[model samples]
Target chain A: MPHTTPQTPGLFSLSLSKTVEFALNQALRLDEAQGAAFKDFEDKTFAVTFTDLGLTLYLFFTSYGVNVQNALQGEADARIETDLPSLLGLRETGRLSRVTLHGDVPLAEALIDALTSIEIDWEEHLSHYTGDLIAFKVGHATRSAMAATQAAKRQAGETLKEYLQFELEVLPTASQLQRFGDSVQRTQAAVDAIETRVQALLDRL
Target chain B: MNQSKKTIDFGFSEVPLEEKVKRVKGVFDSVAGKYDVMNDVMSLGIHRLWKRHTIELSGVRPGQTVLDLAGGTGDLTKAFAKRVGKSGRVVLADINESMVRVGRDRLINEGIAGNVEYTITNAEALAFPDNTFDLATIAFGLRNVTNKDKALAELYRVLKPGGQLMVLEFSKVTQPLLAKAYDFYSFNILPKMGKLIADDEASYQYLAESIRMHPDQDTLKQMMLDAGFDKADYLNMNEGIVALHRGWKY
Candidate 1:
């Protein structure tokens, strides 16, 4: 009932909460605006209940940054209840349709907007430890790898479509699908005409 | 060495009641600088989780007062301050001035000053007014108290009606095999860690003995009930290596 999962197994939740807290605070510090996005949300608490994990993490907004913990002595100002898949969908699509938000709805929406608006200059931060040139090289390599992966994925999809449509004849080709659509439309028209004739005969009777 | 002198247990050794307090103070004073480090090294950083669990169970709310008695180094105090925010107040009180100073300085450095206060007060006789705190905690500091019953009474007295007190301390290990291994580790390896990290072997030795001398889980629950708590219960962590005793004042 309580978010005690973190305390159940060797305090794994505590470690996770600490890691998330540290990362969120670090992100806030690294933001170019210096956490100005969260200024208005100070002292407000947001809770995210991961239904799949059966854990609720409370994110307390402070003047400096956010403090994330699994337990809250009191209720959160905004609580979002969703499973992992829906959460991932929300992240990918930037949509709140999949998750349920309770309490101050406007506050939750604003918090989500603020979170999505956070833009950290990762390359700039990385350059602090690894100088400008090296950081540039690493960032360049990562971008190149991502581009290559996307290209490969597109090529694979095309190849699978060709094999399925041509080689194996397992899926209908474009022309065949068009013909099937026409036939279905024609059949629907014929059925409508037959129904109209039957209704007329019944009216005469 | 008068035969009529009141005596108390200082670790494994018996000493005069007044002397016990002084010696306990000396131990904390010696280890004050390296207390946090020694705790991490000895407990493998699991002490933080134990304290976190205690805080979770406290159900502390904003605008409610909390007293972290024997709050050496203020780990719980820092967490409570964040939750209580600007509206609530937290008092970090400890008997040993050295420990209190370390906790105060650490909390201030972490920018936790506005809603938090620090004090040097004995657990047996807290300085706060009656029914003052909504939540009170004594983590790992109760074992060192000269009179635990008196200290429990003081904690109960300070708590508001419907308030809660959480005591996080080392207790008897539940598993027999683990208990034997823990005994071996506490006696043989723990002191070595203290010696290596804190450079104080004697104080660490006393730490281990005091834990063994502290009351077991059920015993502590009964003591809280005797202290006038309406309800008292305990939860064992790490196979009973540490226990959190909670008492509610109605």
Candidate 2:
């Protein structure tokens, strides 16, 4: 038998809320380092209500992970109502200090911590399709190449700036170029002095 | 439908066994558009909770085969499709083509049809080989069957050994006070609401009468046992206004 005891109803009674929550869980898998900070979210109730979209889902965090339902089975420890844009904004900025909270502030903070802490195991995930060794090698090589590219880009930018400032004389001061503005007059003066000296020397000879 | 000596309960009235299916078809055809809305109102939106509890108790496994008899609107079918997932098979079968079409269309619209198949089948004679299913369910649909005993036997025939059968239906209320209040609401207000919502008063009246005609919880459990199911038991919900009977084949 499949795991009938998935902490929720069977698929025969699968609601949209449960499926959405399942998709979210599958999308986010936490490793130990990032997940340890969110240990406080364990065994807590977090509710997100989208009043405009006509949806309210209660998320129960258990020993394993979270389960979702449309109706609240008990008094929620934290409740927040926001639209899609506000939720997306929260994800990007990560500063939800001003939102109205119905219950424990720490619970909401723990949710943010847990959500932001999710670090997907790309190697393990890719191994499902590709073999483990290949996936690890690919992931490792990709990460190394990215770091090398970033360092090379920084080095190239700094070297270009130095070349422009010292050799090309494009930075810090334009005043040094003022002497070159009358180069033609200076050249003509030197030529005339040289011609006069040459005529005198010839006459003396 | 029996040719010899046959009359079955069509709501409060007795009709030829052959005619009951046609009359039931009429009722469903009349209310197919408003079926989901009426279910919410008639059950006071608690039907979802009841269904959830029923599915929780079913102990269905992945890669298992399920037969959803008279799976009107595919409520349980949709839910089971998720649990069984891609590896499992869930056949949403109904005797009435109108209900089957509605169920198929609704399930497709909801994107729950990946592992599901539709069949137009009568419970009395399921169009499948013996030992075809790992689990079978008849939710709210069994009450409309003209021959409950024959249908029960057919369900027993189709299920594989170690399989389970769950029947969810309106049954005798355990508490007398609540039962009396429920009776008044079922007989009186339910039909009027049906009239207002579905614009079909007689169909809702038949629905109410059909609940009364269906066997009580204990009787249903005994009938399951008689049909070769073992360890038959029932769990009543909402003061027995509804009951879920679970049994298994050895």
Candidate 3:
């Protein structure tokens, strides 16, 4: 568990919170769904505690968007505990399992769900700064790179498995494992027969 | 010749009480457009930190009314408006019409309208009802008021029972070396920067003088207590260059 002692946030922490608030609101604004998922969460407060940073940012939902601040007056509706990396991962993957939630579990689930539901059109946003053709090219290049990386990862895994099983002979082959399983079953049956014979002799005596 | 007429400090100079109001109004009017810019440049962008600390200490909750007295450019008001949500309200009141106009326009441009109200009113005589606001704040504007005690009293009067008042202002520096350097910068560089940027040297000079004339941390805390606050305390930031005085009405 992270230490819960509240220290006064320095200017750097305040600046970080403001930056996060600005980025989150900007993303929500660019959302194709118009952030409709967050409409029901008005006036809800979610305290997100970063274990590594020892900081808690109170995310207060309003009609406009969420306000992130260091100090909160009262108990929040939901509290989430996680490290910095986990929070970043949660944002990228939109997975609630990345953090441990306390207090109103339902509210935490709904908040995360609503946050994940916002669909921002990245290409459209990029095109505002770059021309359509450049944006499309960048997007295409990014997608191709990601796909190539996945393919390479899959190929590397298959090669490693083949090398370990066939060339190195460190791991058993499929047929060898199958035969070993059969031998174990046969030995177990013989042991069962011997146990039955002993039981019969004991009973006669 | 007119000793019977009261005189007050307008910067380092003494002027009639009514003239001081006009002088303060003129200074704000001259710098209203470039107030935010000048603040950033003058403080090396540390004014934002000061204000951030003030907001952190506010501990404001949803559905609570706030009075941002002397809320020029509506920085504090904008933050409070978001925190208070749709049900609550924040009044951005200022003595200078020019300052209020600029603040109102800027806030409106930023889409901070529904929960915020703008008014041009003197701090010594607030236009709100007694025991009305959950929180009241006067930031960087206390020294410009003709009567500091009267303004503090008004802030205390407008706050509801259990509500708090936060005063964020420039104060006397505690360290001698830093104080000497700060004084040199204020008296020498600040006005020139104002002239270079805002085209107003005199107003910036007045700013430095007014800050010097403002009460120190302890004095301001005592003033809040004298104004009927049950408990009063202060937190100095940047080694006493700026202080945040908080008083709770019980």
Candidate 4:
């Protein structure tokens, strides 16, 4: 049996479960397992005890959002089975069957959940902090603009054209400038959006 | 009996097929010594500005590879080597052996030796592996290619992911009055300048005609997109006498 010790929290430290210990002991009897490192021996048989864990981890790490079927197809097409099976104590059909049959899904599911939760938390924190700053800046500009507009209306003295010209000529307050900038940005975004759609259409032709 | 397909337009003039290459070669070979001189003379030193603009648009950085296609006399290639630094490489390639040899010797004489390679390659049939180059440029060379689309596709194939292709070439004039004046200057005055300066009248005449026959801006942009380039766009310069077309492989 392979003896191990815990190293860190949440990260894999030197610790072997009872199933892992049993597999390691059984693997030592095989000629292929002779002179092999503990990590190497465990990798060879973990799949038998952990069935498809190596492939699953490989697919997840390599193609982040790829579907399981596609990942499997890619692995099979690339002839990864022979090397992978031998490397992980999946030497015999019986050992492979045992791992697949006994390995639990809850651990893999828990790992995925933890990773997703971390991503969401980081994004949420950035948005909240940035959004607050933007809103405060916008609010201050709006108040200043409104005051200037009212002052201009008072000074313009009744002729509609003069009042209109005054309104047009009034230096845009920071809020007004921000709104103008936003509109220009939105217009540019729309142009880019349309260009992409048009390009896609052209590509089909 | 079908008339012997005797003459084809080298630009607009009817020239025999055997004569076109000789004519084209004469244009570069004649201008070989004064090519840089005449560029400054003809464009009133705005050629330097245009070449600088091309360099700026190239987005060349340290540790990047660049291929200056149809690079005559090594002007652009010299500037490119400095930007790419000692770690990066620049190849000054031209189809014409005379132009290539002249450019190579000029660069060697200038002591711009390290990190530069010279090759005589046709734009349509570049002897390079696919997706190897970071950037490829055909400065004033696209119009002369026998098959523009094939050359463009070849350029597309050589570019690595996120690589750029820039073409600085003559384009259609936008203003009618400017077009008329340009035509008169190109047809009448340029040949006279060529005869007096370079002593080659027919070669400069071919240059003027080729500019007119070349496709305009919008057509080139569409062709670039068809060649699998994303965000293909052009910037017209000098009332559209010249345009810089840019595209990227992603």
Candidate 5:
């Protein structure tokens, strides 16, 4: 917490919240999905309690813009409580279960849904910090490689399973493990018999 | 506005302290209509981020009182008004009538009336009572004040115990090469752009000079301490192009 209020013993948390708010607003401005998430919920108020710090962050929507503040007193359309670690982790996992909602759970979920809609173009953003060419190349390569690897994984798994089950018949159809083993042994015996006959014929010639 | 017997620095030139406020006001009045526009051109729209950062750092809460001193065009005031909601009180005060008028009108146009109050006030002698606000901010406007020491004292007087005041203003560019390039841009290009956009070059030139005339980062932190702040600190942004100084009146 970086931007905590004057009363709070921790100033850090307030700063962190402020940064988060700025980023959220910036994303909302550029992203239609994120902006639309709050559009339907205008004039709604929600409270988020950082249970560990004993601070309740209240978010209220106004005609102008969304407001994020500490909810000292009063009721809201929704109130959510979660620890700091869980709150941060929710971004990565995209899990609403990490937070507990009191008033309007569905609205809270919708808010999260809006946040999930924000698409981060890390390569484009990083280009400004790093270099344009490097960022583009890296981003492109990463997406291509990831797609190829995922496709290969799915196709390879399916093809190998099908080949073993249908073509080779090495895979058991049911719980008949002994029957499958016998079938494989029978095939092996037939192959051995053919090889032995060929060797005996070759010897006679 | 308070004036001392000693002379004050007015853009590389020392002048009578009494004359600084009127001159500063003249500059702001001349460019009141174009101030926001010039800010966008001069900083390349980075001023918004700087201001947003200041507001974020101020840590203003709902139902808390905030004094947006020198809130020209109500950039900080609009955000504060929204954050404070109906319960909170935000006073968008500026000494310059032109800037204050612009701020009031802008806030009104934005439909932000309930929580915000507009006032024309000199920072050296704030009109409000003691312990009036939980947070006070002077962004890019403190440099224009005639008596900064007196203004800081007045801010301290108005703030509640544990209340914080944030001063976001242009400061020294520490890097020499960057400073030289910045100087070239300010002296050569900024005024020309101002003349083209606002039809006012002197005010833009004054703005550039004022940035240089304002105290450096460490000096401002010391001034905040001397003004009876229990804790004072500053974080430089854009490589010391602007600094956000924060002081707690505990």
Candidate 6:
């Protein structure tokens, strides 16, 4: 049920692939940004603190299916109250770019509040992340299955008899298996047509 | 609500604010002079094979423009110049001045005088106009970038319609035995060689760590696709020790 229609193998269909690709790119970019932050505070005690915060936020978003931008903005809003001054102090000492606080008070308190609110639901969030991974795995497996099915049909000596055997023994499903059989027949017809057209062109030349 | 509290990862290490580029530049500057030699020794000449394969896959005909990002020592640029003929132009770009200088001198010495330009440019913020290049390549480079997604987007923006982008870099070794051997070689022998040859152990250590931290072949192909590339795919070489990813703008 998680799998959608099989992706057509062509330069077209960039829409679906683009979404998956963008998410992966964002994850890697966020990781790189966190690494830079840790390196900047190498000698300071807050180095690990900042690193943990970044990693925690990353894990939290991936697991919870929360939009990262909204979650980050919410955390920033909550941290402005209690810990903003100290956070600003740390940032200054670390020589980091000045972070603009959303609220009047310090930004750290707002972040602390945001983190506290989500701590209770951490497990639930993690489960959602697992679900996303499972969905991706299913999609990958389905694609592989389709490729294998096509490859099996291409082997020589596996003609109508082999096709009959596949329908009777390999696949028991009446509806899905019939659709696949029809697809294979249609593909073969299309390939034969292309070959004939190419031969005709060659003869004319 | 500090909207600017963004974090970034540099290899396996994490850092904050805008220090990522500076650190990356430092890493490259420390090894610029010895980079080419170390590359040859590290891969035992396999790097040449990878670059040659990139050249073949590039399909850059005469009178086509090419931009080689982080084109250290101008190896790819030199090859591209010849292929593009006298009319086509090749740009050799790197963030570090030391690497840029070395590359410029190498190209000049090889008598590749005309139809080539050298610029020191950051991968994150390339200064070219939109849709400028026919082909763009980042060789042994992307892992060192501060914001790889931004760089990819920039690459996409600069490429003309139907332009191609090729990335050649280290990838996850598929075979477990080969991976273990690679790990040992990288952690043990590489730094020692760097110390002896380049007199800089830390830079080589950074190199190993960065490669380990790089996304694998499939992840990177997806990245290219995400950056608006059509028909993105990668070819694994040297038992997946390295990969060549090709994509098209169209």
Q: Rate the local accuracy (lDDT) of all candidates.
A: 0.82, 0.75, 0.84, 0.63, 0.77, 0.66
Q: Count the backbone clashes (under 3 Å) in each candidate.
A: 0, 6, 0, 8, 9, 44
In model 6, how large is the Cα lDDT of residue A77? 22
DockQ of each: 0.15, 0.02, 0.18, 0.01, 0.06, 0.01
Please, what are the lDDT tens digits per residue for candidate 3 over residues B30-95? 999999999999999999889987886676767889999999999999989988899889999998
Worst 10 residues of 4 chain A by lDDT: A1-10
* lDDT score, candidate 5, position B204: 80
Off by over 4 Å in 5: A1-65, A68-205, B1-6
Query: Sort by lDDT, best first: what order?
Result: 3, 1, 5, 2, 6, 4
True contacts kept of 4: 0.00
On residues A1-205, what C-alpha lDDT tens digit does candidate 2 reach at each position? 2222324332222443545455446644435563465556554666676543434566655333455654432356787665434544554566443355668877776676666556433334333434533454466578879999999999998898778878896763344455565776799999999999999999999
Q: Interface RMSD of every candidate?
A: 4.0, 10.5, 5.6, 23.2, 6.7, 22.4
TM-score of each: 0.75, 0.59, 0.76, 0.54, 0.64, 0.56
Q: Per-residue alpha-carbon lDDT of model 4 for B120-172, expressed as tens digits?
A: 88788898899878888888989877668888999999988778888999999
Between prediction 1 and prediction 5, the one with superior DockQ is: 1
Worst 10 residues of 5 chain B by lDDT: B53-62
Q: Per-residue lDDT tens digits of candidate 6, residues B1-250?
A: 4525666677667776477778888888888888889999888987876786676456455567899999988999987786565667899999889999999988898888788999999988999999999999999999988778889999999999878888999999999999999999999999899999999988888889889989899999888888788778888887799988877887
Residue pairs with colliding backbones in model 1 are none
Q: Residue-wise lDDT of candidate 3 within A119-177, one digit each (tens)?
A: 53333433343453344456657887899999999999989888999999898888999
TM-score of the second chain, each candidate in turn, equals: 0.98, 0.97, 0.98, 0.93, 0.95, 0.96
Q: Write the per-residue lDDT of candidate 4 for residues A114-193, one digit (tens) a residue.
A: 22222122222224334543454466467768898998887765555554546775555556779999999999999999
Full-model lDDT, candidate 2: 0.75
Looking at model 4, how many pairs of residues clash?
A: 8
DockQ of 6: 0.01
Instruction: Report each candidate's C-alpha RMSD, comma-separated, in the order given.
Output: 17.2, 28.6, 19.2, 24.2, 19.1, 27.0
lDDT of 5 by residue, B10-125 (tens): 77678887778778888888999988888898999989878866765565555679999998899999988887766688999998999888888887887889888888999999
| Model 2 stretches with alpha carbons more than 4 Å out | A1-205, B1-5
